[model samples]
Target: MSAQRPKILIIGGGFGGLFCARRLAKADVDVTLLDRSAGHLFQPLLYQCATGKLAIGQISRPLREEFAPYPNVKTLLGEAIVLDPDAHTVTVRRPDETEFVIDYDVLVLAAGMRQSYLGHEAFARWAPGMKTLDDALEIRQRIFTAFEIAETLPPGPERASWLTLAVAGGGPTGVELAGQIREVATKTLANEFHSIQPEEARVLLFDGGDRVLKSFAPDLTSRATQALTELGVEMHLGVHVTDVRRDGITVTPKQGGPDQQFAARTVLWTAGVEAVPFARHVAEVLGAPTDRSGRIQVEPDLTVAGHPEIFVIGDLAGREGLPGVAENAMQGGLHAATCIRRDLEGRPRRPYRYRDLGSAAYISHGHALLQLGRVRVSGYLGWLAWGLIHIAFLTGVSNRVSTVATWLASIARPGRFHRAFMLGAADRPEQRYTYSTSDLPAEGHAPGS
Candidate 1:
């Protein structure tokens, strides 16, 4: 560690922190990036991984490999538990149950958001949200296992219940997931089962709102709705889910009509998200103010109100003035980096101004909704644009190639790899103790032991 150079610490390795660290790579400062995971995940493609459309490696890159050439930048794999602004130090807990205290001249908080259970924690037992790679893999296992279970059941209501898939939200993630599940059931798993035809599988997308894709234009939403419906997806709009259990879901329409219960084996929750717990620590430590959602409110420069040295970005920061998208997070990270450089050079800091780059979401095969200024495109052309843009935005060349190859394979064979299943025993901690080296013979030690 060089004492002469100023120390800049960034928390979280998502869009914001990674962008900020990359921008300050050549700057005259010591930059350290810390994240809970060893690899940086491109979250936009998580649904694809969950749906078995892409592998985990195709959407994630190792953090060390990503910043290997930048000697001034160091990476730490840990979870930030506390922030002490007065001492300018952050307390991070490592995976091995050890704590490390790192002091910084300037700190940037970019910890992202997590799934919001919305006071319904019990629903998590049946339906898990898509937030992390583990969550995606678990969901993939659940989905694939449901099909396997359906194969064993007799042809009746039980089979129907096993084949029914429910998505709780109508947002981009939910829509994409519902659409992808429909495609997987119809095209990929069409001929796998003997008793039940995969095409008969029901995919239901439920939303309390009247329309799907509420963020987009009405016409585009209509087109997406139609596209999904054409793909054999059932849309339950304007309905509030009163209860979600393992067997099915009970929903009541907004008009106070009769309660409806739909039998579904797998329910995916993509409704809402709240900032991680660390955001509250940042706020309390720096005395920074936050919005109602517990997201830090930053100034135009991405700095906390009373603390110029402390900056907050990404989903953890509430930019009421700007939209909370991945692009905005990247821009905010760049802005934070620029401000840090300016402060080091004894120059005035510039205000953070966000530029709208538009938004796009894929509904189904060769179909998407794109909004670019006044120009709104839907259908196959929009889907092509979405694919190209995502490929261009991916982090590494290998990831891009892998994603493209998978997409091409899907176009060619549809469901070439959907049959892959988790065959081993489930993860259990007690098994570890049973396989300890102490229980093994000295000359015949097990491979792992």
Candidate 2:
């Protein structure tokens, strides 16, 4: 062999890892991109999928397909379970539990974060977080099924409980969820329901902060509050969700007041996030420091101290003034790729500098918020801008096309197209259908027949 190319191994297929790999596609180094899941998910649109506004396919694309054009990049499906810094190898566990080792000359950790239950893991069973596709599907099931269950029950507190939905968090995700739930009730299922009026559904939003969308400007938050209020989302601020149960949640006032309870059948969580477990493991193995949220602290060049070969980026990266957003991850990925290319070219690496590209949040139909430096836009104008921004950043062209088409269709129609959900084994046993065999058409007398 004339020469050996540098082997670059990247963990996670989120925005950071994927963008980094793409940036290094034409480089001489061989790259291995690995992730636990097979698809690259557009996480910002996950709430839309959960609310039946978009399909799973519209928000995610297969990673292998995404990287097929780059012959130098190889994709693998596995979870990084163990890290050995001395050996420069990472141990990964396959879906079948088989263990394998990947050795690399350069390593990039961008595994991202997961929803935090605030040290209450048990709450996950009752309140599904909007972090993954599975979580979105689970929330979809609970949301649509709750309405179906309510349609069968007589008008009473039980029906009201089934129609009541609770959302924990005042951030972008929580705001989007609360707004979508109300829209789904008032517009989508208004004419579909028979017994209980879907418009009467209750959407309760609880957050410990004094106001919603704390990350945005105060004026933008006020606009968002007005939109949500008009849409009928009950805002319960200055309260912490102390307990989450199967049928309801208990909230305690942050300023020291008596705890209160709200009965709800559907609970969605988007309060906080912590670095994924593998990121924590990598921090320990590499002797790197991490924050309380388990984000690995990186040097100015986005590399671990004393370990130039190792780079940490994205939400798992802990840096002052670096917001845990997609734009940061994308920029960090490009910077890391540039550093690698510079090393190959015998040039000195430069520090990573982040550019503030602003942030956006959707409130309801024809309402959104967009904030740039000293510039804020809300209402219909912000809504249009929000659509354009999301479409521009969405992963694939096909996904963008489909998502836009779906959105247009949703605007013209009164019902959600992707509302189907499957019942799990546990739920199947407890389900009681309202209709029987008599409700179906006779064997040879189908509607078409």
Candidate 3:
């Protein structure tokens, strides 16, 4: 072994990457964390931002600031495009469209997952997925704009269509998003509109699965369904969405029935997610096997089976029928870090054993279902537990305090929806200024010019 410390490169700034970096802070390794975004986003609370319950800045913190205490760690703002495992080099595209290469003795691939439309890319133009801060803000705009448009429509189906909101998927994200929307409509937006009562707005929660919160116990699912129903949300279970378009969505029941079409202005898809493209690149580069979800098949120690030096974690690493949750990603990151640390110190590495911390889903208004092993709690108490646990798990004191204050304010007044929409001048298609990390014009250049 060389006398110099090994250089470690982590490809993500999510839960997995963040945890691994923190764990290896004191180790004799040079750590470099790379991500396209400048800050670390608390993903679980992204739905709140979409619903205007929280702002985008409230749920994110600067990545450099978070890792500043550890002098051995460095943050790079760039997107990794190619990973040459044989050469131990990573090629990344900087914001200036320049490619940079970094040599790494150890690499952790945790690029994470992105929204999967299942071969329906066209649907993205109308119904956006909640993944990044921009996505959340765009959805928030669509939601608030729906109400704004409804105020001008005559009282009829046209108005109802404008007030209607449809959410596809019944997983934790969809459930939490639907619940937050219900609260916003019934509470925050109750008296805001003149021609319509936001409380009567139609919020549809659709799931192809047989029930919501499928990962939870059956009893908990039943309770969640009941709570959502009480909150006036129309639950469509076991229904496959046939088509999603700008107008609406068409669905067919799983039991073989007539197709049902609903006309709505806002449609949100949280149904499925697939591993980011980097995972496939890694698998192809290493000639390693991967599962159907495009996640690399790693060993028990969270390292690539054939190439032990390369580690894969988070949603990009596949385990047999394992649910890709934040907890799983964190555990995988820690395991990979531990393995690397042990190898460096000439110690035996421990296999990763996932501990099920249970699952919780927030249902309508102030109710929730929590399953902690044999213990299951429902209703208000469960909601309290859920809030406390989430608050505790949130990173940084500013985010925690801001989230708590937002929750308390929502509970106290419940009609204060922060409206900060700025409508700019209209422009032609060619003149439209689209904002994205990958595509931005030069500092002084006009969008169209």
Candidate 4:
């Protein structure tokens, strides 16, 4: 609506938002990119950072630095709290909770999803999900600190509890986290400590599905299972994590059976994800239909019904056959950009057609799985392809180079140079949980039968 160049407002700096902005970098438009976080996280490799295989800097790039070359793109740090589609304005809350307004002619909602606790939000204190930089750091701290705590305790149940790690999810994130933890225990910290054998640590992976990596073919899943088993990861499939506490988790069979309790000090959650809070608010204001997970249903052109100026993409877009993956998000972003360009030129906009680029998952050291159409590759060959695909998709040349260097060094030796983690309020026991001591399970025994 501006007499000047059209004002384009993009909410989020993830794959979708970033790609859209980059495509419009030289366009005759003023772009405002807003995100709650300063850096654009490379989420696929978040587990690597959590397990110390890569540094946070290697997996994330600051938005300011990323957009320094794009004169038309102005990046701001804020969380979009309210949407006024009718007025073409959005209210954003700053880091200090102060509110401001942003006006736009065209809006792009690429704000991605957040870790979902399903229905139990209280489980968050005990189980940290793999979604953000803070989550990665928190998991890293828990992992390394658990090892250190185990070293101090003599051979006993408490030490074993500290050495036990649990991951709740069979998806790519869960599988990657489980495998990386085992690899870290058996390889990186195997001989680093004299008090206890780090290789003896137990990593339990739990999922309600019958097998891990259910997105892949049965053979690929079988190969992943074998690789995980060989890496010393105990797979507990066909079970649901019913309850989580400060000390352990209770798993009940999905087919209805007695519950089994596992004492684990560190639990990483990658079970599910839902739209971020802002995305939900946007959906409400726009009267858009969303799937169960809060993904807004969009027209074929990635626009809301009766609101073609507003585009929704990435994990937040609910469309048939549109997988919530980085490749899909990137392509969606470009499509949205192309639509906007076409609109400016008075040309008819085309519907978005998502191209499936397949999927890849890293299992362990020198092992991975890659599937594209009928082409299924596993083991060393698959690992190489997986690495190439990731490296090519990673943003920025510096990040790609550093990540490759780090990977090569890690492969050549057992040393993990980025193992350092911080301990702040996490060091305090009283600040951990709101529940009283009476809420804990009986000593030496779990609560459920």
Candidate 5:
């Protein structure tokens, strides 16, 4: 290592971390990016993967491949268990459970948030969140398998249970998942089943808020809700889930009503997320204040209040009004890199100013919702914008090409043709397990943070 070169350690490979490493490639510093996952995921399209509109390879690229052109950048797969900003050292645990210490002159904490089951961490098994490749794969399997199971079962409570799909949280993820799931069941798998009419599947999007896509404008939210309803998704607004059972979920209407039990064999959680357990260590070690969500409170320069050399970006940073979206993470990462570069030259570090590129949710084939500041768009034009933006933002050209090809095929097919409800794994449904309510911290992230 050169004495003049600073050792920069970035603790994630999400949008923010990857871009940060790229921005620092030619800065004459060694950049080591550590993530538990092997690839950098294009998270905005994760809902597509969950709905079978895309394959894993279409939305993720190997982290090593992303930095191969830059000799100064290195990628490693490991869980960051501990962060010591004062000591300028991070303790990483490898896949084998072996721990190693790495010292850095500057540290960037882009470690993203993990899927939160609200207060019920145990609900994860019944309904997986659409965050990581594994999460999406599990959902796709569970969903398709549900149809197959429903086909085999007699027309009874069990069959009805198998046909029910519940999506918790009407945010972008839930909206996208609900809409696509409706499309798959109603349009894509229209003729794939025998005894079961896939269109009969009861798809529900339940949210505690008054409307879906609460982050978007009211008009846009209303349009998204209408789109979901037209596609046969039941939008149950102002409802809070109290318990998640293997057979279904129990919820109480937030507006005062008797508790209700919705029979859903599969439920997907898109409700909430907290920072990784690692963030708690940062806050505890630094006496930094974090909200109930456990994100770190950082200075405007994206560093801990008193720890100037330590930067927290993405979902981990508790920036006052910043949304927990990909754009904020990307901006935070780039700004942190800029600050590091400026600091290297004995200059002042610049504050991070997040720019919202807007929030969007994909609604079925030719529908979507886009919100950028005061502007709101929906319907076919919105879908085009959504498709173009996601394709353009994919990690690499290959990913983009593959996604384009995938989209083209969907256009050419009946829809979600990825599965034929074959007599394979779908023949044997996964047994339901008892979900626990213990609030355990999240282990690692699936890209977004």
Candidate 6:
């Protein structure tokens, strides 16, 4: 081995990889962060982008710019199709469809999860998800286009079908999407449309659980339900969406409701998520097990069972009972970096520990729900807290300031949604599979001596 510092490879530009890169900023190590997307998306606020409340640019920052201050850290835009743990190499597929290999002394896997169709992968053709920029843009198109399409159709079920919006899964993403659609129909797009009354649009939220936001406390769930009811969202609880077609969906509600089919042209699927396919590759390469969700069963130190040099953090690791939220990724990334530093210094690596930083969800208009441990706040106060907290969590100073300004402007202006449908032509096209590490101007660092 040459007398150079150890090399680190971090995958996924989400919270885990981003945080892990930051944690190793001043360390005596070389880090290369890879992600398929060019930007590091603030996924929590992605609902806003889908709803036209915030532009995509405001929430996603380029990974290259995010880590420009750290000379030891480099950002590469590409996807990892294969991970060879025994060989300590990752095979990357670039946007151009070519492939290359990069060897590493240590690796951090955090490729994040993708929207799942609950065994109905065919459902994806009709009901797109709210996970990526493409997904958001596609949902936005379907939404606004539905409204526009409704204008021409004569008054009937066809018009109603165009007016209806069905959102699968009553989780945070589903709730936020439903709430925003309600606001648009009742308040934002009220006077703008001519043929069909926007207020007449039907917004449906379906969930398998008896209550929404199941991860939150009971009282908060009750509060959110009440708020959603006031917004005119039809909550179909104890329901399982069995099938999704181009025109509608089939739901089997546990409440003894008949196998009912809801007719709606627009659908958003936020029901479930499985780790990115790369996780399965990692599990296979490591001879490790994975949960039903396809997330790797990582050890206490956020590493594979017997591979101390390889760490799996964030949405890709499932052994820990941590929620797949931003907080988990942030803390888990930090833990991986700390353990790596310890190993480099000839010290024992520590077990990974996660800190529950609480959770919050923005409902609509001036309403929100915030939960910090045992305490729960709802309504406008919670909404205010949500705003402040999200702004604080944004990556950069400029992004934070501009995001606040843009948010305020969006709230003040209702006409913004009128023009969003024109930005993209496709309604949720297939994602591009890409990743890279060779584009860096600097020479690759030799592995640990």
> Per-prediction TM-score, please?
0.92, 0.93, 0.92, 0.95, 0.92, 0.92
Ranking by lDDT: 4, 2, 6, 1, 5, 3
Per-residue lDDT tens digits for candidate 4, residues 1-449, read 45679999999999999999999999999999999996799999999889888899998999999899989999999999999988999999999999999999999999999999998887886788989998998899899999998999999999999999999999999999999999989988988998999999999999999999999999999999999999999999899998987878999998988999999978889999999999999889888998999999999999999898899999999999999899988998999999988888889999999988999999987899999999999998998888889888888989999988887776677467889986545447744522236446567854332
As for model 5, its CA RMSD to the true structure in angstroms is 5.2
Q: For model 2, how does the per-residue alpha-carbon lDDT over 388-417 read when each residue is reduced to its tens digit?
A: 898888898898898888777756663578
Off by over 4 Å in 5: 1-3, 412-414, 420-449
Q: What's the residue-level lDDT of 325 in candidate 5? A: 87
Name the lDDT of candidate 1.
Answer: 0.84
* Best candidate, TM-score: 4
Cα lDDT tens digits, model 1, 1-449, are 23579899999898899899999999999999999996789988888888887788888998899999999999999999988877889899999989999999889888888887677766776688999997888678777777878899999998899899999999899999999988889877888789878899899999999998888889899999989989999999999777776678988999888999999988889987887888887887777777766888888788889788888887777767676678888888999999988877879999888888888998877788899889999887898888887887788788889888877776656564643545333355433322134333347532212
Instruction: Go through the candidates in order and give each one's C-alpha lDDT.
Output: 0.84, 0.89, 0.82, 0.90, 0.83, 0.84
In model 2, how large is the Cα lDDT of residue 98?
Answer: 95
Q: How accurate is candidate 5 locally (lDDT)?
A: 0.83
Predicted structure 2, TM vs. truth: 0.93
What local lDDT score does residue 449 receive in model 6, on the 0 to 100 scale? 6
Alpha-carbon RMSD to native, per candidate: 7.0, 7.5, 5.1, 3.1, 5.2, 8.8
lDDT of 1 at 290: 79
